[model samples]
Target: MENEKDGELLSYSVTLNSQVVEESKELIKSTGGKLSPILNNLLKKWVEMNKVNSENKE
Candidate 1:
């Protein structure tokens, strides 16, 4: 599948604690937010942070 502007989409299976999943779901629901975007933002931040760290080590 292709995202609106982020290119191709890849699917992966992940496991998380059941309690955490439920709590996150509730929080997202209360805020009218979806999980995909939240996860994407978090992953993007992680990637950017790692890139900066790698550059600093060079």
Candidate 2:
């Protein structure tokens, strides 16, 4: 499948809290969603919010 990565993708592994993972899995299933875009959007929003807040504080 074509991804937002423009056909080039990277993979890595990390350890996460099992409880967090389970909760996230339930949320994803309930939403009928996938992980990649959700995570990407969340990270993007986090960065944008941080930038805006920093600017406000400056």
Candidate 3:
């Protein structure tokens, strides 16, 4: 169902450290992965981490 698929989408706003921003910027500049793609990747990572952590709490 659409709702199930939607649940897989990553959505968040996480504050990044200055060093992390600089590192990600460098990666984007060198790899040309585009800003949105980089951010999307980070968001997905956060979602996965949260899911794993929440599951462990059960």
Per model, how many backbone clashes are there? 0, 0, 0
- Report each candidate's C-alpha RMSD, comma-separated, in the order given: 13.8, 14.7, 11.8
lDDT against true structure, model 2: 0.49
- Tens digits of per-residue lDDT, candidate 3, 1-58, equal 8866654442211222333445655665676655587685885465556555554544
lDDT of 2 at 6: 39
lDDT of 2 by residue, 2-57 (tens): 66463333211112233344455566666665557868467445555655554454
| Global fold similarity of model 3 (TM-score) | 0.40
Candidate closer to the true structure by lDDT (higher is better), 1 or 3:
3
Q: Please give the distance, in angstroms, between residue 30's alpha carbon in candidate 2 and its true position after superposition.
A: 29
Off by over 4 Å in 1: 1-35
The clash tally of candidate 3 reads 0
* Model 3 whole-model lDDT (C-alpha atoms): 0.53
Candidate 2: residue 21 lDDT (0-100):
47
Best by lDDT: 3
Error of 3 at 50 (Å): 0.3
As a whole number from 0 to 100, the lDDT of residue 19 in candidate 3 is 38
